[model samples]
Target: MKEENLIVRSVTKKKYSSYAGEITPATPNLIQRNFKAEAPDKK
Candidate 1:
């Protein structure tokens, strides 16, 4: 990408504050960092 003068656009991150101090259920990691794909360009 550098050779083609390509650049990556980044998203601006905003914080969510709903129920910030309340007790809530924990979120699960379904994939668990296993990002392998059977074919190229597939998630």
Candidate 2:
């Protein structure tokens, strides 16, 4: 049970870090690219 809880916590932390990475200025171009790729399909 403890191992299972630890795994869940690690997964949650990884998800938060992944999301945090997107909004960081270091990857601003990456966000722009993602929006560009999606915009054409939306229109």
Candidate 3:
């Protein structure tokens, strides 16, 4: 019988709000709530 070696890795998850803080002045939603598609090609 043979034994195999295993490796483990660790990762740190980042928060969306934390990343947004890096930017100066939050961006505005120019499109607003208008989600109507103009045309099939444009969409």
Candidate 4:
């Protein structure tokens, strides 16, 4: 292969992203980063 001067092609993998886009949420943020609750298994 070296003497023949042959080359091989390669494909690169696409990068993954978590960004969806600018859009309104389906439901309102009821938690609002509030994880504490009055009782256990409440929140």
Candidate 5:
């Protein structure tokens, strides 16, 4: 039980950090660009 709690706490902290990192102003546009780039080639 104690080990599980520690693992959950560490995962939660990392998730929060990742969430904070993802909300930056540049994130959306970069994601959109990459998404477009990855689409099937129109040929």
Candidate 6:
């Protein structure tokens, strides 16, 4: 029962989500966020 208290109880029972409410509306972004890179090997 040591190993640094089982790695601090497995990092305080880790489970995290910042998926921003898990986007819905039948989810389809497909780069529509337009991370613009018209050149440089098209990013």
What TM-score would every model get versus the actual structure?
Answer: 0.30, 0.12, 0.33, 0.34, 0.12, 0.17
Clash pairs (backbone) in predicted model 3 = none
| Top candidate (lDDT) | 4
* C-alpha lDDT (0 to 100) for residue 25 of candidate 5: 52
lDDT, each prediction:
0.85, 0.49, 0.66, 0.91, 0.48, 0.68
**lDDT: the better of candidates 4 and 5:** 4
lDDT, residue 9, model 4? 80
Candidate 4 has its poorest 10 consecutive residues by lDDT at 21-30
Which regions of candidate 3 are displaced past 4 Å? 1-23, 41-43
lDDT of 2 by residue, 3-42 (tens): 6665434434433443444454453454555545555667
Candidate 1 lDDT over residue span 1-43, tens digit each: 9899999999999887676686889899876898998998876
Candidate 1, which ten residues in sequence have the lowest lDDT sum?
15-24
RMSD of each: 19.2, 13.5, 8.4, 5.4, 12.3, 10.7
Q: Pick out the ten consecutive residues of candidate 3 with the lowest summed lDDT.
A: 1-10
With a 3 Å backbone cut-off (N, CA, C), the pairs that clash in candidate 6 are none
Better of 1 and 5 by TM-score: 1
Question: What is residue 27's positional error in candidate 6, in angstroms?
Answer: 7.4
- Expressed as tens digits, the lDDT of each residue in 1-43 for candidate 4 is 8999999989999899989999886998889999989999997
Tens-place lDDT per residue, model 5, 14-42, is: 33343444555544453444545445773
* Stretches > 4 Å off in candidate 2: 6-43
> Once superposed on the true structure, which residue ranges of model 5 sit more than 4 Å away at CA?
6-43
